[model samples]
Target: MTKMIFLNLPVKDLATATAFYEAIGCVKNEQFSNENASSMVWSETITFQLLQHGYYQTFTTKPTADAHATSGMLIALSRDSREEVDAMVEAAARSGGQADVREPQDLGFMYLRSFADPDGHDFEPAYMDMGSVG
Candidate 1:
């Protein structure tokens, strides 16, 4: 069975990145955090590894993608409501990040907004009304 999920990101400044994630409401799990990396917890089953650029290189030979220059992937999170989605995006902006990477979108049952962290990692916070789907 899939026990847990860890999303690892290469960051330029560990301290700055750690603070950015924390500012957006993630909890840091000290047991898996250190100077080189931080384990930011989103939920009991989901954790994000914010690794220093050099430390991240130890795991791969390919050049790390410059998050600011390009989009390799998009990190998406679910919010409880449309207002929560907007609030998160606002928080990211207040925390020295870029908010509204794209125009906010609203479908009949879904609301979404994108933001970029200080390190240029992109994230999408979304709200979906399950009652509208099967």
Candidate 2:
């Protein structure tokens, strides 16, 4: 079996978070989703599990970090081109997500833009041109 990644995140509102992800091109996997949690498919090998804060706490004893209060983690997704990266940022803003979390970065062969979901989880959409790399 191929190894897959499941990134679990705590959310204040499952529906809103799920919708935010959907609006930005992720598809929900109903097979692994429920009222308190959603399995958002980012790629064939990557699934992001958005769990309601209380539901998420059941998974571990550690306190759930308040993403809005402090930096938790940054989730980066790859795009096909620089335009795609910019488009995703636009989509995120239209879907009630916030951009300007960090300044957009362009490094000739790579481009990145950051946004925060309604729950304040950071996501960076990036594009890289391997052909342009020296």
Candidate 3:
């Protein structure tokens, strides 16, 4: 069986979070979504489970971190080309997300840019040219 990843994120509002994910090209899997959560599919093997803060707390004993003020993890997504990375960031910014949370990086073979969703979950969209790598 192929391995898959499900990233669970605590969100402030389900509707806004769902819209933001959709704007960035994720398809919502309504079969797995409800009032308290949204199952956003980024690709065949990756899905983001956006859970409302109250509902999310039930999953763990620890308090949910205020992502806007605290950093927990940074998710990096691979894009096919540099333009694709830029497009995703642009889409994110237009969809109520903050673009360029960190400075863009270019190292010839690889290019990366970062953004934060409305809830402040940081994501880095990157593209790497394998042929250009030493």
Q: Which candidate leads the pack in lDDT? A: 3
| Ten residues in sequence with the least summed lDDT for candidate 1 | 16-25
Tens digits of per-residue lDDT, candidate 2, 49-131, equal: 99999999999999999888899679899999988999999989999899868899999999999999998889999999999
> Who is ahead in lDDT, 1 or 2?
1
The C-alpha lDDT values of all candidates are 0.93, 0.92, 0.98
TM values, all candidates: 0.95, 0.96, 0.98
Number of clashing pairs per prediction, in order = 0, 0, 0
CA lDDT for candidate 2: 0.92
CA-only RMSD, every prediction: 1.3, 0.9, 0.6
The full ranking of all candidates by lDDT, starting with the best, is 3, 1, 2
- Output the better candidate (1/3) by TM-score: 3
Error of 3 at 16 (Å): 0.4
Model 1's TM-score against the true structure: 0.95
